[model samples]
Target: MNDLRSWRVPLPQTAVKCAATVVLAALAVLSTGDPQLVFLAGIAALGAGALALRDLLAPVRLTADAEGLTVVSGYAGKRRVPWPDVTAVRVDERQRLLMRTRLLEIETRDDLHLLSTFDLGEDVRDVEAELLRLSARD
Candidate 1:
């Protein structure tokens, strides 16, 4: 039997990018004189920035089951890998989870998401341990 566990990745880059976009947009608004153009740009930039932030702040969920592992990155996309196909699991120097499989490379970059800005951290070890346990079962 394979036990299951879940993990989320830390996000810092996302937040920083979102903040920079917002700040730049604000600056643009201040520098522009046309009310119509300024309003339109401001709305567009702010809206896009907010959406980007939402994506960054969203969770990157990792769920492991008997057959394989499923990684759902908010609305970005999802990755499912069978245990038997996984070739290696390692933590990179950047602290990202590097998962290599027969067909894919799953790089979980903790700093690329925005959750870390809020001091949120994920337990990659738990996910790695579950993957190990499942791989052994097979």
Candidate 2:
């Protein structure tokens, strides 16, 4: 295998959001003093903490080698697709009113894998170009 290239999903902002959620939940429990409110806040704090821990522990990683690509998604586990199995690589764009987003889709013989811009940490066009170059070598 050629030198393995890896990209880490950006999560500093997400970590901040998670921490804020937990803090707010704690404050709600302390100020409200309502059993129901406390319970709800506890649940929210747990959920947010779990998400934060998941991101910290099993952070999303995208790796490419001479053979193919590997995606390690937190909680969702990992997936590996060889270049021979990849039939097409394209960018899928979605627009919702004024908001627009792009995703990289890798079409294999039997499945389609979607990669978010956040996970790629680079432009989809550049990733596509690299994938094409690596695939062409084989």
Candidate 3:
């Protein structure tokens, strides 16, 4: 088996955003005595804190080797698909709002796995090429 190669979702930016949200929520609660504003701030803080903790605890990771592919998604935990189980690997593009995003779709005999570009940390095409190369060796 070859060495396992791993890719992780980029979270520094998200960490910063979460921190900013918490700070802003704190400031809002401190600056105003209004109960309504304070309640809203508290809710914001809770949501932001939850997101931060989730990102810290369960980061998305993708690992591949001679054997197969492993995906560790936040909240979803981990899933492993062996090479023989993978029926196809392709790049999928979707438009959300005004932005277009690319993702890697791995189709197994009984299931499908979608990996975001953020999680793959590389061009979907490159990941697809690697998948093809690894699958060919089987």
Candidate 4:
């Protein structure tokens, strides 16, 4: 449990998907001369390109260290949480449609942050264990 100290998690899959969306939309815009279709495709391409840039750029989705954690706020900015402010970090497991899903839950006084494997790029149990170890030292 004490082998780790910090972590930076990024959503690579999402970035790849966004990049693909941008490419496909750009192609659609180029292929169609219809004003309405071109306009829609151009908008879609721009939005996906923005999202792709965000995902590919340096500010990763989640970062953790001995002092605290920081998460990118969808496109707004980064949100930092000190260790003292963290109330709990656990795996929230649920069953739906005959499938089991697990998410990492980080709770604070005012907010509950839930992260999936797609978000963390790591198993929730592993993340929970590392987080517990970090918090235990504090």
Candidate 5:
């Protein structure tokens, strides 16, 4: 049974693009004739813009199989967590499942390893029940 789906964060790209544009514009105005400072600020702004763009484009996927759990997101890239290594899994404040493969959320907060939320909204209770049942078995 392959459950494939996707969820999106709100206005990820728009906000990023707007902020980047504003920063670049500001840098341009303040730059005057200082090439070095302008260059550095421009680079920083571009980097932030790139990160935001990445988040906007990245896909978060959750897949289960005979092997185990897999989370695919642009930030964390692709990761597979064997069932044994999974300590706990729960939906986070952002609605993404938080998977603990090791030392809790200390490592990453990106939902790269997220399971798909495609049809979860319509069957939340059933899904929770299923998760509880599976967790108990483990």
Candidate 6:
């Protein structure tokens, strides 16, 4: 990552989960002809599919560069954070369901963004280290 001017990390596993949600919801709609079930499933499929579509279409969950970090926001928009605004970058780990979960925490002047392995498709520690390096260069 040293020579790279920018890094765009994709959420492949999260996209797969979203796609699975859509498929499962659609199956539920088909299996049960109930109007309520159909309506609920339709909502689920559309909502989940639309979000995942943004990732699948652009294939980017997060982006980092010399200037700042960019992350997916809204339906198809991006939120940018300048390097100066970033206050801290760290990896947080916790126990969940008999396993450990790790996430990268990006603290800005006014906000805190936590990204999981599913969201980054990379180990949080590695991402944090890379981010720290970039910030140091800044």
Top lDDT: which candidate number? 3
How well does candidate 3 score on lDDT at residue 70?
86
- How many clashes would you count in candidate 3? 0
Q: Compared with the true structure, what per-residue lDDT tens digits does model 3 show for residues 1-138?
A: 585777665778467758867796886769677888778777778777776665566565678888998876446478888988888899998899999988889888888778777666678889888888877753
The regions of model 4 sitting more than 4 angstroms off are 1-15, 33-47, 74-76
- Please identify model 5 stretches exceeding 4 Å from their true place: 1-7, 29-32, 59-68, 72-76, 90-138
Q: lDDT (0-100) at residue 128 of candidate 6?
A: 84
Per-candidate TM-scores read 0.48, 0.74, 0.74, 0.71, 0.43, 0.73
How far does residue 15 in candidate 5 sit from its true spot (Å)? 3.2
- lDDT agreement of model 6 with the native: 0.72
Candidate 3 residue pairs that clash: none
Q: Write the residue-wise lDDT of candidate 1 on 53-134 in tens digits.
A: 6556555555667787776545656667776555565432243368432212243333122222122244444444456676
The candidate, 1 or 3, that scores higher on TM-score is 3
Q: Per-residue lDDT tens digits of candidate 4, residues 1-138? A: 323343344566756768777776877767686888777777777777776666566335567777788766646377889889988887999999999999888898778888777666778899888887766654
Q: How accurate is candidate 5 locally (lDDT)?
A: 0.49
Worst 10 residues of 6 by lDDT: 1-10
What's the CA RMSD of model 3 in angstroms? 3.0
lDDT of 6 at 104: 84
The RMSD of every model to the true structure, in order and in angstroms, is 8.5, 3.1, 3.0, 3.5, 8.3, 3.4
Off by over 4 Å in 2: 31-47
lDDT of 1: 0.55
By summed lDDT, the worst window of 10 consecutive residues in model 4 runs over: 1-10
